[model samples]
Target: MAKITYIEHNGTEHVVEVANGMTVMEGARDNSIPGIEADCGGACACSTCHVYVHPDWVDRLPGKDSMEEDMLDFAYEPDTQRSRLTCQLKVTDALDGLVVQLPEKQI
Candidate 1:
């Protein structure tokens, strides 16, 4: 399992232990973290799961794919460098302490 932290725009924090192989979006949803909407599930077809990966960990994550980049154009408050769709981030042993901050809004 990996321990992931989800910080809301309001500074609320949710730390969860997520199974490896699950998406970050799934971890938040399963743990009842309020900020991740994940409207399209993990399909990468929507931007409701947008998050800002902590700067310290950004370089550790896999680069975003073209499809995720295109979808992020629809995110509520986009940040070209830090923005990511949580659904695109898979939990793994190597990402045990990943931290992601939620936007002020999803829709």
Candidate 2:
């Protein structure tokens, strides 16, 4: 299992144990992490699951695909370097202590 830590805009953190092969969005949704609406589920069709990858761990994640890139363009605060659709990040042992910072708002 991978341990995913979600830090809300106000700095509150929610830690969830995610099974390998599951997306971050799924983990957040399953754990009821308040900020990750994930309206489009894990389809990469919405920016509701937008999150900022902790700068130190960015390189550990995979590069975004075109679809995720397009969706991110509509994010509330698209960060060229750290912004990502959580739906696109799958949990893995390599991401055991993955920490994602939530945006102030999802709109």
Best-performing candidate as measured by lDDT: 1
> In model 1, which regions exceed 4 Å deviation?
none
Q: Tell me the whole-model lDDT of each prediction, alpha carbons only.
A: 0.93, 0.91
lDDT of 1 by residue, 1-107 (tens): 99999999999888899999999999999999997889888899999999999999989999999999999999997988899999999889999999999999997
What is the TM-score (0 to 1) of candidate 1? 0.97
Residue 2 CA error for candidate 2 (Å)? 0.6
lDDT of 1: 0.93
- TM values, all candidates: 0.97, 0.97
Clashing pairs in 1: none
| Model 2 misplaced stretches (Cα beyond 4 Å) | none
Candidates' RMSD to native: 0.7, 0.7
